[model samples]
Target: GAGVSQTPSNKVTEKGKYVELRCDPISGHTALYWYRQSLGQGPEFLIYFQGTGAADDSGLPNDRFFAVRPEGSVSTLKIQRTERGDSAVYLCASSSRGWRTDTQYFGPGTRLTVL
Candidate 1:
């Protein structure tokens, strides 16, 4: 429809808690990506999904981070056992093609604060 939409613009949680961040990509865009941004650093790639399968997920720090695009349109990023170090802005993006296409649109990130 419009651009990517993220729910719960901000979140506050305690350590050991879990959080799920959602992303709704642009219509007809088949390439979706997730990124995490910490203070004083640019966004870091967390995963990339082409259609329903993940094309790349190497940027995910560990098993605690996971993503899924079961329907190829909306995706979700799941964080398990939240830590203070995990606090950051979770960004979602979508592109017409794939990596380095120069047309990726990013969403207003969900700011997660782990207390």
Candidate 2:
């Protein structure tokens, strides 16, 4: 069985460009999360999905960042008008249950570079 995985392990784009980052969680996991890790900082929570709907998205920085778990399996993180400050490693995680105590398995992460 495959673990959590993200596409386009490295992405480079100009400022103000639109980008879509994809994540595929482990099969049968009900909890999914998206995080962003900036230089010298730990991964910061971006969004969480319990099923097909977003359970919490308070961590998203602004309107430019959005994520979706349409089928409760695969998710996509869409960024509009990307900025240089958006350059960071995007991470995805999954767990069997969406509880505070559940152990999360993380993906390798997608490194996004905005020029």
- As a whole number from 0 to 100, the lDDT of residue 5 in candidate 1 is 93
Report the C-alpha lDDT of model 2 over 32-109, residue by residue, as the tens digit: 999999989999999999999998999999999999888889999999999999999999999998888998999999
Clashes of each: 0, 0
How do the residues 1-115 of candidate 1 rate in per-residue lDDT, one tens digit apiece? Answer: 6998998799999999999999999998999999999988999999999999999999999999999999999999999999999999999999987758559899999999999
Model 1 Cα shift for residue 59 (angstroms): 0.3
Overall local distance difference test of candidate 2? 0.96
Query: Which model scores highest in TM-score?
Result: 2
Estimate candidate 1's alpha-carbon lDDT, on a 0 to 1 scale: 0.94
Runs of candidate 1 exceeding 4 Å displacement: none
